[model samples]
Target: MAATAATLALDVASCLSHRWSWLLFALPLLGVASIGLFRLLKLPLGVQPGSVVEDVRNDDRVPPALAPAALVGTFFTVLGGGSAGATATSLAMASSAASGLGRAFGLAPRGAKAHRLVHRGWTAACGMAAACSALYGAPLAGTLFALELVRFDGAVARRLPILLGASFVAWLVAMPLAGGYALPAAAAPDPSWQVAALCVLVGLACAAAGTVFGWALRALRRAFVRSPAHPALVVAAGGAVVSVLVFAFGWQRFEGSGLTLVYAAFDGTSEPFDFAVKALLTTVTLGFGFKGGEVMPSLCIGALLGASFAALLGVDPSFAAAMGSVAFFAAAARCPLAAVLLAAETFGWAVAPWAALAVFPAYMGSTDVGMFGRGLTGRLSRAKRTARDKRRREKER
Candidate 1:
């Protein structure tokens, strides 16, 4: 009997030694830290400034002036050519979190408030990394992103100080390396009642558009993942499809990520063809498993669509595009605060009013899909309310 008991104990120990067996406690920290680091360093991952933005106002500077057309043709040959640090950077950060940090550091993964804080900090790190990398000049954006996107629980709010600390650290690291596309030091555009109304409209349109984008991409991805065709064949077919589209449409809009096109849209240099080709090309790239982020491509599509609508509405295209960008993200991800912070970070304070205006409707319109299963109740409201209600009902019972 003693021998059997000993044998059982030994078996339990052996089973617990497997790496994945520890995941119930380790996974959360890994998830958090990797995301944190990804947000910290992902900004400098694209085409250089002035080179990508087509500032028609400065058309004399051949490169910036011709960036629109040249980008279409030239971007394909380059490595990591687009302004796409957000998704890649964040993914890398998440990977880091998952890789070894949690285990190496013996961090807590799941449990009560204090334990959750440690994990939350790690997860929030991704948002910080993203903010630092994407906005660089604006650390607040990174911090808010952590809160808006990563927190998801009111209790995590207690860790705000820690998140802010990481964001500040990330910002300090980012500033020197941020190069030309650093956060513009200007204020956001003034909140015109006209702009606010326009933002509402843009938000609604983006909600519908974002839902379509999410569903379409999922369909395409499902088709690719399930197809009996070889992976290489699938990729080659995708590349060929993109090539054909580029050739037929002309490269002014449908290359990688369409950052060039997005920048062009901001500069008022994009044509309708640019929008169409980019939208089609992006869907194809994601479908083929190129390993990229969708936020920018989706933003590009929304901006173009918004710009087109703005022209009809007699509103400013840049303003409308800004709102559309965030609105689409909010709808797609159900991340309203992150979407708003992102708008402010990328543009300026002026963007906040419009972003806020757009976020609500977009969030309302968003379909129930997200990159990581982020839900609409958002991080802060979901858990606490449920927990409180449960306790209350239990007490009554």
Candidate 2:
């Protein structure tokens, strides 16, 4: 259902873009409309994709309204040409539905709070796995993504098989409806030390890019929070900026999730600054209270940046692009293992080893808190405080 909603929204947007080109001028109005819908539904503004997953991981009860609110919000945001992806929407919807089902089934019996919490976690994980698998068309990657995103705690560990089964079944059901998201196969690079070294450089570059992207998103959200203007005004202003960008860059190049640009990078036809443009636009669209996921934009950024790196270093653009797509997402999301599996599933296992090299460097070099995880800076500070306290106690003893 989430996939269908996304597909239908994109199809409508495409039709409008081609037939009613003048609608570009009314983007601000559309943005206002999206926010208005959310406001009418009494949902909070700037609800991010990761927040829902975070709630599930923390074993917080998922609100029944979250699924519909997210779907409606994402649909309108994309319809207005916001830089967002539907994968997050799918995850949100599925997880919320799972939570609702658990409640209906009385998964939490009296005096069994611990049992209820575990049940909630695993059911949400299963839903997430199914949604991701159906959307990406990679059941293994989808399953691993759910596990990694939620962290492989005891609760998740006990229910691993169930999650995997859910993902596979979802993929099987969605295959005919949405099809797998497959990229063109690139020739595997020869295993040479020089190529391996270059992969490290690519990873570092992408990690840096990921850091910047995360900072930009946080900065924008902070700015929005601090602004004195009404949210409607802020949203309208964001839409206006997006309109200008669309007019400056071809609409087709910046539309929807920028998957077209990803394909272009794979084909070695992306512009030099495609990544920069996407990063900026995505930052603006998402930061200004738009509802959508960052996963696709992250992949888009990595693919374009990798393609550019390949062009400069005299390497295979497709191969570099494939690596960048996975490495950058790993750095930004802080999920290297899942990313490696994603690389293997999408680009064939032949690319897995090189992808690992890129992924780890990107992961290690990443400084900013990832898009989905809790703030890394905060985590580091807490750790430092804990160590300091421990040392003081030892000295006193």
Candidate 3:
């Protein structure tokens, strides 16, 4: 059995080594184009209408000209109160572009076999690199995210090489973007064991915040589907509410992706309430019709809340903010592995263990309900069916 397994692994590795897989190259182009297109279309319209373009040019999934929608959505998220980012949409586009490009090639076997082996792999690689580069200011996090989140078969040996190659290529492409990423120039944590412990507590708080965020999105979905409110109006209302809350709390930190606020939270730059309020605003923003990505804003909120908790605990704000960012991401995305990698990549080795440690409770405390639907355990369709069955049984009784 051992020999057979080794042989199989070798076979898989050999197959993966083939350069016949040229689809990976197409991924970055799609990613850059998709994001660009999402921005371009929206710029002229002055409104974000998120939709997939059915038209195509060659193998490209999202043309640069049509990427304005995603950008506009992101703008609303930052300037307004929409609680989303470029990651989700970009992932979707990457997957679509891969599949579309694969179909155009017509070189592989048709049907499910081709789709599974080629298109899926290509798209997965693209998403991996995009997520890694965008989240941690490099391609590593996105690669890990794609491998961990999308690739379920652990024993599949060939996946690693593809992932590494994709990540490297993406990093190379992004190197022009202000030396990869321009992290906020901020003070380092003062030496204190107490600061580390505070990070753990901040992690816990982030877990709680994740739960609240989950519940808020759920509530919004319920109301939106059930209510007579217009979708655009509902989204607009949420934005207005966020504006009002920002004014009331004097927390501009709550606005947009909250990156600036997140940086400030490191040194107690913003009030704790500011973080809490931004969390509320993002949840409400996304709960309505505003479409974007949720990761960045959530990071900002978690950092602020964590810093506040650290202050309350008499620990370092910087440490707390760092922990909060990772913990909340883990809880919200249900991707602890990705979250830790993001933390490590974002802050380097200094905080990797702490980030990993915080992810557990944050996962535990998080209710699993996220923008994707439910918590980590079940699919949305399955959960809905289960709920329906329970209702039926109750009615029969």
Alpha carbon deviation, residue 21, candidate 2 (Å): 2.3
Per-residue alpha-carbon lDDT of candidate 2 for residues 117-136, written as tens digits (9 for 90 to 100): 44566677788888878877
Model 1: residues with Cα > 4 Å off, grouped in runs: 1-86, 94-99, 109-136, 151-158, 179-193, 378-397
lDDT of 1 by residue, 331-385 (tens): 8656677778777777876668777888888888777565434463643367689
TM-score of each: 0.66, 0.91, 0.70
- Give the clashing pairs for model 2: none
* lDDT accuracy of residue 269 in candidate 1: 63
Q: What lDDT score is found at residue 372 in candidate 2? A: 78
Q: What is each predicted model's overall lDDT from 0 to 1? A: 0.50, 0.78, 0.55
Could you give candidate 3's per-residue lDDT for residues 283-317 as a string of tens digits?
Answer: 76666545555666667777777778776777667
lDDT over C-alpha atoms for residue 9 of model 1: 29
